[model samples]
Target chain A: MTYCVAMKLDSGMVFASDSRTNAGIDNISKFGKMRVFTRVGQRVIVTLSAGNLSITQSALNLLEQRARTNPDALGIWNAISLYDIAGLLGEAMREVKNRDGEFLRQNNIDASASFIVGGQIAGETQRLFQVYSEGNFIEASLETPYFQIGEIKYGKPIIDRILTPATDLTEATQCTLVSFDSTMRSNVSVGLPIDLLVYRNDSLSVDIQQRIEDGDPYFSQLATRWSEGLRGVFVNLPKPDWLTPKI
Target chain B: MTYCVAMKLDSGMVFASDSRTNAGIDNISKFGKMRVFTRVGQRVIVTLSAGNLSITQSALNLLEQRARTNPDALGIWNAISLYDIAGLLGEAMREVKNRDGEFLRQNNIDASASFIVGGQIAGETQRLFQVYSEGNFIEASLETPYFQIGEIKYGKPIIDRILTPATDLTEATQCTLVSFDSTMRSNVSVGLPIDLLVYRNDSLSVDIQQRIEDGDPYFSQLATRWSEGLRGVFVNLPKPDWLTPKI
Candidate 1:
């Protein structure tokens, strides 16, 4: 299982993904699930993936190979819109499904994948999409300014509560980390070494692509302070009056 | 969908369930999912259900009818151990499955139900069981002192962060409410008018059963304060140093 969340806020877009991938309780490994593609002044596209590691790898490999084969081809760098980039990703996964879906189905493995592709396209605004394995996608709107793929629920409440279209880039970054912290705390399958990137609107370069590992002071303090602060807030909240003994 | 959570703490046990039930977005209704059965001095059994409404209702009806028809029968009150009571509830569900499972399956409806049955029996300490659709159940242990059924993940992180075997009843009650608040905040399928029951250790009766209706002052205040407190804590958490524009 994996947890990846991306926010298309007013100031920019934020992306975060945990590195822990597991086949079972004992079979766990660290694999970066976030992919960054930047064309300096043209675009900065980030993609986060979840589901069937083999399929994810295959799809990503195909996308990279496509870019390497023809720099001016149908890859993300040449896509006309951010939505087009998402469709390209979906098409890559669909190609993988065409190749491996049947073999996996024969073995009872579901050939499924989920992705969050978000960023800007030169003159266009920041956009985000949650692409399904079926090669279809939907763009984020003001009403829903975020997209999350994979083990999303444990971290959803905080994002639902704290983030909005009007959130700033830095604040949304912090909120994204807190959301990942909540997820990692609850699920052992989503461990440390996080890929966090913040795309400031119109900044067609990926400068804040921080691959945060465990014990990073800033992240450690942020996680510890968030937990302690939540405890303090929880303890200070009103206790159950109905349970108090009546005199 | 539904949200039900039960905590087995050193001070006692706490159970809570939201009232919203929906087959789909269009078919929404409110129904109390928590049922409390008590023999004042002998036992206090609270059961919370999350699954096919017909199956759960049928199972509860069976348990009720069995107890009323034969006081000495294998009913909740007559059960020897808390485990037996859980088994009895499981048996009731199994009976429902046997009666309706095939018909429902024929119609493509999965005849499944999940339950959290927890309370104290005569000469027994407080116990909690998460009864699955198959009627088999697992007892909550010190390491895993809580069980959540239906839409569990959104509200899971809070309880996982706060509750422990050493937590007190009132604190656990507060924690459960906060958990429900998070669930309701994120998922519209889980709505208001919560059923909250606090079972004190060794007290074989139901005294603190609060059917908290929407706009109930205490609940309203708690929810508001909690939301505000969380926002405050979130804002105060240390921001990411990597994202701050140098100096």
Candidate 2:
């Protein structure tokens, strides 16, 4: 289980992913789920993955192999647009499926992996896309400016309430972290050592790619403050007076 | 799809269930998922259900039918303990499965249903139980005071934050409604016309059982106030300073 969220705000994009993975309650491990591909000032592509770790890692390795052996081929570094990056990623997924799908199916493990690919490529606009197990993808639009993969529901209410196309990057980033915090608090499968990246549109480079651990000052402060704020609001709401006499 | 939540607090118990049922999106209809059985001043039993409406309705009908026929069998009204009522409901579920399981399975539909049953029976303490499709049930303990069924995730965060054994009946009731409101906002399958039941410990008969529709004054007020309150909290939280620099 993992939780990754990416927002395509008017100002830029925000990507966050949790690092914990578990086969069951007893077998848990920490692994980085966010992969960054960048050519400094030319392009930056962030991919957050969830599902079978082996499959996803294999797919990533295959993509990197392509980039190394054939830089001029359609790999992440050379992809002209975010859509092309998504396609190349999808192609990598299919390649993995062709190689491992039958063996995994025989062992009753579905050849599964999904990703959120978002960032800027040289000439195109910043965009976010959610890639599916089938290697198909859908880009975020103005109406739905964010995409969430993995344990999404526990953290979705806050995002649904506060995010919009016009939301500033600062607020969106805060909201994403808060969303991650809420999810982590409720679900043990999603844990610390979060990978957070913020990209300012047209920069064509990684902006703020920080690793947030258990005691990161800003994240800790924001989480504690938000929880307290929620409690305060909860208490301030008028109690259902009608319930007094009835129950 | 349906959403129902129930909590057993030291003060009493709270049960809330949405009234939407759908065979498909186009075939959606309204039916109360909550059923109340009360022998005034003696006992009150509330059952909130989710899943195949036909199966749950059949199970409830069987329980009621047995009460009418045998009277001394494990009928809710005759049960001496809340656990007995849960057992009776679970037995009823098995009966439904025995009767309809083959036909449903042949059609490739799951003979699935789950219930949150809570109340006070004469001579026994107040209790809550979550009954499963297999006619098995588990009682809520102090550590986990609440149970939710059907489309549960969207509304889970509020309960995780607010519910505790010491939470007062009024606060628990409000929290349950807010949880339902969050779920209803995000899911089309779970809608208005909610059935909310509140039970006070020791006082067997229901304290309040209200039918809350889309325009019910108190609920409408709470919904509006909650949304505004959440937005207010979002704005009040200090934005991460990092993104501001990028912008």
lDDT per residue (tens digit) for residues B83-132 in model 1:
99899889899988998899889889867789999998888788899999
Please state what fraction of the native interface contacts candidate 2 reproduces: 0.65
Task: Tell me which residue pairs clash in candidate 1.
Answer: none
Check candidate 2 and list the clashing pairs. A246-B207
The residue ranges of model 2 lying beyond 4 angstroms of the native Cα positions read none
Q: What count of clashes does model 1 give?
A: 0
CAPRI grade, predicted model 2: medium
Q: What is the TM-score of chain A alone in each candidate?
A: 0.95, 0.95
Residue-level lDDT of model 2, residues A172-231, one tens digit each, is 888998899889888989999999998888887888988888888888988888888888
Q: Can you give the lDDT of residue B247 in candidate 1? A: 12
The candidates' DockQ values read 0.67, 0.71
lDDT tens digits, residues B83-195, model 2?
A: 88888888888888898999999999877999999999888889999998888999999999999999999899889998899999888988998998889888889999999
